[model samples]
Target: MEPIVILTLLAAMIILLLILGAPFKSFKWIGTGAVRLLIGALFLFFLNTFGGIFEYHLPINLFTASVSGFLGVPGIVALIFLDMMVVN
Candidate 1:
């Protein structure tokens, strides 16, 4: 994309946020969500690392991260199920 188009889209996004009147609050939620994503990723990393000892490893990528991030513990469980039922 052109720089002008990028700027326009960015400006439009900012304007929309301002119109919504909760930009800062939304950013707070974004920050919290980002933290959750990181935590979930780290949890999966540790799980994969430890499972390596047992010759079981879960693939870590955007899909898994999003799953774990959005769904929390249930997401981890689902990944485990996938690993056991599908990958294995």
Candidate 2:
């Protein structure tokens, strides 16, 4: 797309959002979910890093991250158990 066209569309979107007001609830939900996902990723990273000595690992992806993020430690344990069952 042309730069001018993109700029115009961006400006229009900003104006529309400003006129309608931002959705605080949606933003809060999204922000919370994003933070959880980040935390989940960190959990997995540490798990993999430390668990490496024990020869354990779990793939870091959306579903796993969501499960771990929303469910916390239990989620990671569940993933490990599930991986064991599936892989073996």
Candidate 3:
């Protein structure tokens, strides 16, 4: 689809939601998930920065971010383990 068409549809949806008043619970859940994803990405960024010294680098993408965000430190460790044992 065209960019303009997608934007128009998105705008219409937003306006409709505003008029209809979206559920507070859903918004809260979405906000929490978004924050977690951001935190997860930050974790990966720091890891890459320091791990670079050890030649350790993990791609920052949706799957990794989600795992780290939702599962926290253990998730990062697991990814590292997988990278070392499987990828190599």
Candidate 4:
């Protein structure tokens, strides 16, 4: 599909949702979650990069990203602990 067509469709969807009075608070949470997810993914990427010196690394994937995004710091710790357990 063309870019213009896609954008038009998106705009129409937004207009329709607005006319229907869609709850925007949920959208706010979704946006926030997306931002947090990106941050979490980047955090894991950097951790593995610098951690190479300490012989530490964490696999960055959808599962890890979602976990860290939803659970924040504790999720990363959990992944580390799980990695250690599996390795040992």
RMSD of each: 10.2, 10.7, 8.6, 9.1
Error in Å for residue 69 of model 2: 0.5
Alpha-carbon local distance difference test for all models: 0.71, 0.77, 0.78, 0.72
Clashing pairs in 4: none
Off by over 4 Å in 2: 1-23
lDDT of 3 by residue, 1-88 (tens): 7645644664565455556553687686665676677667777877887899999899989999889989999999999999999999
**Each model's TM-score?**
0.63, 0.71, 0.72, 0.63
Please, what are the lDDT tens digits per residue for candidate 4 over residues 1-88? 7645644664565455446553687686655565566666766866787789999978878788778867888998898999999876
Alpha carbon lDDT at 11, candidate 3: 54
Per lDDT, the best of the predicted structures is 3
CA displacement after TM-score superposition, residue 77 of candidate 3 (Å): 0.5
| Of 1 and 4, the candidate ranking higher by TM-score | 1
Candidate 2: pairs in clash: none
lDDT of model 2 at position 66: 89
Scanning candidate 3 in windows of ten residues, the lowest lDDT window is 13-22
Q: TM-score for model 4?
A: 0.63
* Tens digit per residue, CA lDDT, model 2, 24-87: 8767666567667766776787788789999988988999988998999999999999999988
